[model samples]
Target chain A: MSTFIQTLHLAWQNTNSLLCVGLDPEPTKFPGALANRSDAIFDFCRKIVDATAPFACAFKPQIAYFAAHRAEDQLEQLIAHIHLKHPALPVILDAKRGDIGSTAEQYAREAFERYRADAVTVNPYMGFDSLEPYLEHKDKGVIVLCRTSNPGGSDLQFLDVGGRPLYQTVAQRAAEKWNTNGQLGLVVGATFPKEIELVRSLVGDMPLLIPGIGAQGGDVEATVRAGRTAAGTGMLINSSRAIIYAGNGDDYADAAALAAQKTRDGINAYR
Target chain B: MSTFIQTLHLAWQNTNSLLCVGLDPEPTKFPGALANRSDAIFDFCRKIVDATAPFACAFKPQIAYFAAHRAEDQLEQLIAHIHLKHPALPVILDAKRGDIGSTAEQYAREAFERYRADAVTVNPYMGFDSLEPYLEHKDKGVIVLCRTSNPGGSDLQFLDVGGRPLYQTVAQRAAEKWNTNGQLGLVVGATFPKEIELVRSLVGDMPLLIPGIGAQGGDVEATVRAGRTAAGTGMLINSSRAIIYAGNGDDYADAAALAAQKTRDGINAYR
Candidate 1:
């Protein structure tokens, strides 16, 4: 199998898309049959995946969203379906997991083995050892949270560390010291395109997972302009609620597909 | 219903035990019948909890250990068992989960509603919003990771932010601003007694969940002296593998109980 980043590059070329469809399934937000709690998270995500697969470069399913509803089994099925049908598209398990050494190993297994994700998002607060276990997975991608999309992200991330922001230090570390496997990426929020640009300067050509674009009101042009590499690639622009819940009706999948296309085109215009 | 801190205080008083028995089950490390795969995580942890209950002020089940083995159902069952048998002892689910606002809500549901954990450990990397959801749980404890037990914790926790270390800054925030609910606590690793002392001084009698003491080689006396409040309470000294896996034979539960009692008495001496 090609490496996770390689597979992502392949998807970018084949589909000509940088859109990473975030599958954050809220049971209450589902339309029609999927909402009644019978046909569940798996069904809704499967439908959205099938509808938007061609237009998306990656799929990031936030683990909390699955684990909250105890829909992990369904999440497993959803990833299995994605691998079977949309093999080229990488699935990033957005589980910002951080812990000590041995515990970190289990979290890595949960992401790579239990769920069989191509990539996983991790929190950098615990430092290198917390991330070392995840990086040991040869072909999988380990994306570190640098500048998060939330407004409260600044609460700690912007603390000055040696005249540079903490997020910049994280980006520098992830780019320089932590990318031992060469299968690493950094999460720079779409809302903070300037920080994204700063991270881009720090980590040359490393993949950036950009969240907070569509529903969170991040500027698409600024995100693309700030994060994209020389090849006009290297960014996964994520839109979750905006795309997946575009319509609260029976044609939700169709609406999701349209939204995914619009998002993909919007990023491409800036590229 | 008593608040999470009140319940923890009650447990400490009733048991006269500062020890928190951490049930981190690695199936491979199981002894005899439990190791054969016929008996599962719940069975292993249930036995350990039953044996160590008298000596432990609380029980902390690390989520990664269960989720790694596709044992979420067992985790749910185990927490239910803890509530059923040891109603007085609080169960702190050590998940170390962190995310943005909306997703954090789902995680809060998982910890408080699905698993019914009395308290949960959270990573503070994403800042206040990531924690707001967990804080919303009326009587459940929200324990933020300050200075972790792992050596790698120094990677970011010790970064200089305005002449003070990052972890002290975290402790200040958790105590001053984030404890909107009376149920807030901080995870100050037993390994860092100096930092723990600093944290205690910052957040006056707030409960500090102290991990890394037993298997990780943290000094019990130092941990107890540094973390305890004026009333000789306000700490949950967690020992996971050191207590739970004290034996490799069928009498593992008996050995775990022995270890738990010894650990409890050791802390009581310091108090």
Candidate 2:
């Protein structure tokens, strides 16, 4: 079995579900009870982790939200807390880092070594050289941007490179050429279910990180249908704001847990 | 005049030189005197800025080094100091940030609205939408990664796409299509002089941020030859480590000043 399949098996056993809770703690959107305090962000994340740890397979923290508030240290602390508290739960640093050569090496060191994330999201514009550094961490996964679940993602990703859209070519290249370490995955945004199907076909058995199911208007049923690999082996459905900030009061953690359970139920129902 | 031409004129008038000192203050490379302290990084950068201000048209700070040590706050303080001390010196934030749509807008806000940099480097992988936010700042320049200086850059950049290398196509697109706001420039690494010349031909008059000149073994004369536009515009030759860490003692500032002067002299002699 591929490393991705083994990760899925572990995720399934740990959470009894494939729900990936997104830890995108935007400061402005923080609950009134925790506003104006940086530590509140950590508090909020820790509580969510505690509440949903039993129901979620992995935790994906969007780096941009933390970076915007100069909360890198807070993020590091949160990741450490996740590892220490729930050692089996994988931490995917959603940094979307892509650069060339030595700079790429530095980023790999920053994300995997210093930050100690189990996986990282990378943009494939600079091509394979950028991905190589991340793949060197054989035990960790390198998720490449295939067909993103955003409004403007189609603008460039769907551009006709030859007879087909660029993203299709990217998916094929990633599956055939770039998976030397068998640690490759593609981020197929949940919003674009049709593109998800196309990417699924191209990438074959590679794991798919299907984001945008909650706040981004992606149909959960269609995403599950389109993103599933052979025999449904590789799909990580991610929901950030929908799960974390499901409610704004003292019941936030319960609300998050309920949201996560609902997403898992939705996926299972479709299956 | 294009923003590129205007910047060239500004450089010639203010510093009487085409040199840019890159403040890539890696914490690991710092002398034993000021090791592992955020304040020390700022102090070191301040000294370099003060000493090199007269000889350099601008200062470029690689955000990675600061971020590596979790010294972004220190970097912000140092940049604020540079603005106050040398108001005429343009500060370029070498951040190489790119994302899809709304996320890119947030990044633009962080780099331009918050950091207040005169210019910020960006990647073109996610296409025009990722860059749209940066272009909204009419006066600030956006340096797009065209053909990088690293040895592994050519792995994908030189791939044949419609009978031209991908980088050349990017240059053409930037010049003809993406420069709608006239705020676009290209980062052509000094190490790849021939490719730099090719990109120059395609870009016509777009300003180029030429990195990899000093410690990266790029020939100063050859870089200038390939980068300068027909009107003697474009080209900002950046030297980071050689200028910033010229000495390790209290007299490091003086050594940095001398180094800056020498680099400027080299460019002028070549011109």
Candidate 3:
């Protein structure tokens, strides 16, 4: 099995895109036409995938979106569909799961074996042992949440430990110790440019799953400047609501494709 | 719509037990009789629930266990069964979920609406906003992860922020600012008695879901002594593998009951 990072790089090269389409299908936000379907979420997501596939380096389905609606079957089907139709695109299951050893193993199984996610985002609050379970799956990727793209992200992440911010320590730790299988990645929100630069320098060329690009108001230019490695690779700039919900009418799929293409071009121009 | 704490207190008073039996069914560990059965995980959990219901103040089914086996339907059945048979006991879904606002809302829905869990564990790494979505569910409990029970827990948790450890900061923040709905709780491991004492004092009478008792080798006396409030009524000692996997025979459920009873009595003696 190819490493998750290698698979992601292949997808990036094939699509010429850094844009990762976040497949978070909130039922209330769906296009009006799909309101009455038995499997509306899955049907809606299939259209989004069909429209946006060519422009995405990766597809991220925030598990909460599926789990919330008790629509995990849809999520499973979406992942399988993405794999079958767009094999080059890596899927990141954005479920920030963190726990002790035994339980962590189960979560690892959920992401890798059950959903077949190429990568899964995890919280590092429980320390290395919690992360070890995820890391044990050598071929799959473990994207550790560093500095998230949210207002409250700073509450705990920006704490000064020793002389550096906690997120910096997290970045340094992930690169040095936790990358044993060469399957580790960092999640730094595009909203914080300086932190992105700080983290980019720490992890070298390891992939950065950079959210906050679209819906969360992260600047594409600054994100491209700060997050990319010297080799001009290593970022998955994700856009969820902005691209997927661009049109709330029956032409939503076409709108999603156009939005994805625009975002992909925006990142490319900056690069 | 009684607050989760009040509901927990009522159950604690009625059951006269502080023991929370963790219903994490690993398929590989199942006894011979149920090994080949299609619905083995659910069947195994049902018997365990029947045997141990009398000794528990709460039942915590770790979501990873069910997700790993793709036996979520069983998990759903188990939770529904627990609610139907033991209506007074709150089911705490041990899914250490952490995400940003909109996504957090979906996770909140998953835990409360879908699973109908009374309480759920959440990681505090992403800060207050990540937690707010869970808190919005007024009557449900928000148990934040603090001073976890793993060897690597101290790696990030003990990092000093200004004058206090990060976990202490987390505890202080959760108690003072985040507990607005009066539905907040803390998870301090039984393995860390001093940390338990530290957290218990900080949170006052807020309940503590203390794991690490049985398979993790936490001391019952130390846990009860350090974790109890002045009223001696603020701790739920959890034991998963040690109790559930006690005897690998036809009497596995009986063994689980015996282990749970012993753990309960041990906690009682300390109280």
In angstroms, give how far residue A2 of model 3 lies from its true place: 6.2
Best of the candidates, TM-score = 1
Clashing pairs in 2: none
User: What would the per-residue lDDT of candidate 1 be over residues A1-271, giving only the tens digit for each residue?
Assistant: 2299899899888999999999999888887666576548899999999999989999999988888887889999999999999998999999999998899999999999999999999998999999999888889999999999998999999999999899999988888898887888989899988889999999999999999998999999999999999989999999999999998998999999999999898889989
The CAPRI classification for model 2 reads as: acceptable
| lDDT score for residue A264 of model 2 | 87
Candidate that scores best on DockQ: 1
C-alpha root-mean-square deviation, each candidate: 1.3, 3.0, 1.4
Off by over 4 Å in 1: B37-39
- Chain B only, TM-score of each candidate: 0.98, 0.94, 0.98
Candidate 1 achieves a global lDDT of 0.91
| The best candidate in terms of lDDT | 1
Clashes of 3: 0
lDDT of 1 by residue, B76-120 (tens): 999999999999999999999999989999999999999999999
Tens digits of per-residue lDDT for model 2, B32-138: 77875549889888888999999998889877677766677888888899889988777888888877666777677777766778888988767777888888878
Off by over 4 Å in 3: none
Expressed as tens digits, the lDDT of each residue in A85-191 for candidate 2 is 98777888887877665567777877887788888888777778778888877788888888877666765566566677778878998999988978888898888
